[model samples]
Target chain A: MNRKISIRMSGLGGQGVVTAAHILGVATTLEGLVSTVNPFFGAEKRLAPAESYVRISSSQIDERGEVLYPNIIMIFHPHVITLGKCYTMPFFDGLQPEGILIINSEQPLDLSKEDLTKLGQLNARLFYLPATQIATQVAETELSTNIAMLGGLVGVTRLVSVEAIRESLAERFGGRKFLASATTAALDDVLKSKFAQVTQLVDRNMEVVHKASEAVQEYFIKKKEAGSLCMLR
Target chain B: MIEQKIVEPEYLFFQADREEVFITGSEALKEAIKRANVDMAISYPITPQSESMHLVGDLYVEGYVREYFRGENEFAVMSAVAGASMGGVRVFTATGGPGTLRAFEIFPAWAGARVPVVCAFMTRGVNSPLSIQPDTIEMAFMLHTGIVMFHAETAQDLYDMLLKAFVIAEKPDVHIPVGVFADGFFVTHTREKVKIDPAEIKLPPYNPYSSPVPVMDMENVPVRHMRDPFVMKSNFISYAAHASWQQEILAAAERARKHIHKYLGGLVETENEEAEILIIASGTAVSQSREAIALACQEGLNAGLVKIKSIRPFPEEEIRKLTQKAKAVIVPEFNRVGWLCKEIKSVVEDNTKVVGGPRVFGGMTMPPHLILAEIRRCSQ
Candidate 1:
């Protein structure tokens, strides 16, 4: 909701971390906001650590390269923290006060007492979702976990509208650029694939996104209801 | 009175039929080439500079480009491109860093022959130990290449400059090669909003008849008596002939200045005019300087920026005029050699006031904070 919001997303190579950042950028732009998605430099290989920075703003953005101070962080894979697979030391380093941290895990993070204390000192908000599980169940592909995480991001941050993201998905898969008839045909082609067409894929992904987003809202609401002494589970 | 040669670019930002799109610098250059109705694009792939050519290849497939191919190497690519340009078609080719050096020998000849070709040089560190990262040391060698140069600050600038490059290079008075330069990865990979003219209304094709010297062809004209070079006995004539040709190349580049100002608005772009501390930079370094100046202004530091968009003409007049009243000129560059700084000091008076080398090379970033520190130091 600020003029600018910087998010750092970390995961292994080939996990679609860059694509997620790109989708976020496209969504932000469609929402009449500006955004830049920067993938890590150098040649990235499968299983190697990869990270991307996405900066969305209502005004112009001139900053280039990595995001040093992020208002939000998305852990596309738990290994980014456990295996120390990131350019930034400690992975969560330089997280701003009251920052939002979203982890793609089925349960709470295995952070040490010191790390937890640091997060508490910063008053950071934390959330987790079984992204891979959700992707596998809905899209029948773990690769779609990034999409689920994006859904989770929108649900939690409410920074961009869901309508904008749907339009982004249509623009991306519909091959709709430059022509109106092509947009309709492309949407039909995508939705009519063996997975059905592009529209079917987009609609299915949107469903997963909606569910993941709702789950985050419900989980956080329940946590607050249980008070400050709530269990990690 | 100031000459009335240049006009503000605001009027042409998004012309009536134009569209605004978000794309990488590489893609922006490709769009410019497409709109310019380029005849040929011969290239060999290298990091950071590769995508521009790939998009050109797409244009070829889309029937917008007449000819496109990948050469065996940069040398072959430039040779093919020069050959095509001399054959009287508007041609383009791109190389970066080591690739630039691999093809460096052909550049001067491209200008000398007055081919009016355009080449994109995406700045990268030449290989010592094999660095594919962004660096501007490659620019140091190009300053003497007899080619006109345009160093872009952002994706939009890259788009605008590449389009202008074709028009500038093909001018009858300016039949010289133009090198459109942008930093590797930094600008090439950074996606930003760019406004471009629609395809239908782009610049017209290169007219070979417009060239001062004719395109290479031997058939039509009757063979006449051999020129005086055959009877020349002294090395003096040879040297004089070569010397005058070199002077002609320089003259051509000089002629390009008016066109550059007309097309690019001016060779040097300034921001925050009254600041005492002046930051002189080009390409991606200019982007960092903009941020640094903003930060300095927030803290009440009197600072401004003079970004060199045209590196070949050197913007000497503008730099001289701008730095006349400034207390100190700080030059931030991405290359360790600080070629831009050296050029600035070479032109501007009070060399002691000009400080260069708050630099980062080998793909490392030159953050605004680093430049801010230099501004703070100079303010004292």
Candidate 2:
């Protein structure tokens, strides 16, 4: 009955996953929602795997701690898929049937049939966006990929307004005007792009989200109908 | 002098009914912060002291406290509090033995600049064996480093001393970094009932010193008044700076002694006026010594105790007068034999035979009975 959403963002160091987590938290808080952002990072220099979390809810959060089983998982790097022993994978276990998973990568990934079978055991929905490619197309580099992935997240979850995300980005990167402008532009492109060829990648990512949400909704409707039938019988 | 309130003399007894609650020294610390009206606290998690940081984080989420900063490390935590204090906010921080050692470099910078940063230090024995138990080795070694240090004897003391530490540290004359030290195993992990009274505590406003802000001019431009060559040659300016430092130290010490005497009243005292044997101790050692003395008295041994409330500037005069009547003095400290007891022996001088009992084995609680035995042996 709670309208709470837990999101985990992870990537190799320097990809700005930590910053993206904070931006998401601040944006969600700005939209009259309660949010918490926590990061788990070591003293590793650039290129090491870094992970952060964000939790947003309509009401005050009782748990002021870690995200054990997150509702959404954002993988910002493509290669981490191969690093199968990453600590965040356990959070995907026993997820709610309607939970959403978003991954940000440069190319569409083909999970081995074996991996797909493992994922099918959990009833949650999964969506992956080639955020690096979209960022490179709009910003001329992958420097703004975190922001691009954030745009896709806002578009999908609608947990926080895109304008709130923009405001948070501007506030956090106020000193770095060039970076802020590039990120804003990238986010705007994701929001404005049509369902066409050059933007076909973004459209495909959206299609995955759309289909997953529909499947989740259908599963829940069947569950409720089954419950009513049982009560009548 | 403010007129002292006349209240009924009652024994300070711990309410046993509340002991069943699972609480740690870290929880006591957070309760102290809430009572002291601390506006913000920032810390990074580390062993033995992480619970204090977690407690503050919990309170902030509960809306009982405001603005808790989760920093990257001990360095960030200390610097962030320094910055927050400069911005006129009452800020606090907590760290354990290793974390405190890591933060050691920032102490003089904060003290010399006179930032009233309040921190709770859980004194764990350092190096080699690497035990995280309560010991005063760190506190004894670092006491003279321009920060005011208060040792908490009990869980209640941790709560009370911390509340007092912020008030005393933020005073105009004593605007130096202050720490409330508790033994890591004995106090850091120990749980007891701590009285929390928000209404009785009054947090003073932040008042920065009148000196101009320090800035490094890499361009070699003349910033403020430059040192005059003539004055430097005459040694007048050099002498004046040295004298100024001496006077500042004396003034700060006098102010703390006077404030403790005036505010704390009977709680700060020298006992058994005619007794020829004086034992000086601080923090939990005082409680241990008191228990020892009580047992010694039962066994018909005559010895007195002097519990030091403030360790910085060493309270030399008060200690000297207290030990003047004694033919022999014993100092029991929870540190290596060479530090605080040696300092006390040096102060009390040759006339009084001084006996030093340092906790050679780290983290061992010297029982009162053992202390009584030590007193009997020393007297014989």
In angstroms, the error of model 2 at B43 is 1.2
lDDT of 2: 0.61
What residue runs in model 1 are displaced by over 4 Å at the alpha carbon? A112-121, A176-194, A217-233, B1-16, B219-234
RMSD of each: 5.7, 17.9
Specify the highest-lDDT model's number: 1
Deviation of model 1 at A218, angstroms: 11
Candidate 1: tens digits of C-alpha lDDT, residues A1-233: 54578899989876778767767888888788888877766666777888888888888787676777789999989888887887788766789898898889887666666566667677788888788888888877676788889988987888888887787777666653321122333433533463657787788888878877866532231233232323443
Listed in order, each prediction's TM-score against the native is 0.90, 0.53
Least accurate 10 contiguous residues by lDDT in model 2 chain A:
A224-233
* Deviation of model 2 at B288, angstroms: 1.5
For residue B255, model 1's alpha carbon misses the true position, in angstroms, by 1.3
Q: Count steric clashes of candidate 2.
A: 2
Among residues 3 or more apart in sequence or in different chains, the pairs in candidate 1 whose N, CA or C atoms overlap within 3 Å are: A190-A197, A190-A198, A191-A196, A191-A197, A191-A198, A191-A199, A192-A196, A192-A197, A193-A196, A193-A197
lDDT (Cα, tens digit) per residue for candidate 2, span A22-126:
677777767767665645523323577767667687764422223555677777887667665244564356355456666674334555544444455554455
Interface RMSD of each: 5.2, 16.9
lDDT score for residue B239 of model 2 = 81
Task: Compose the digit string of candidate 2's lDDT tens values, residues B346-378.
Answer: 677573477777354455556555566678887
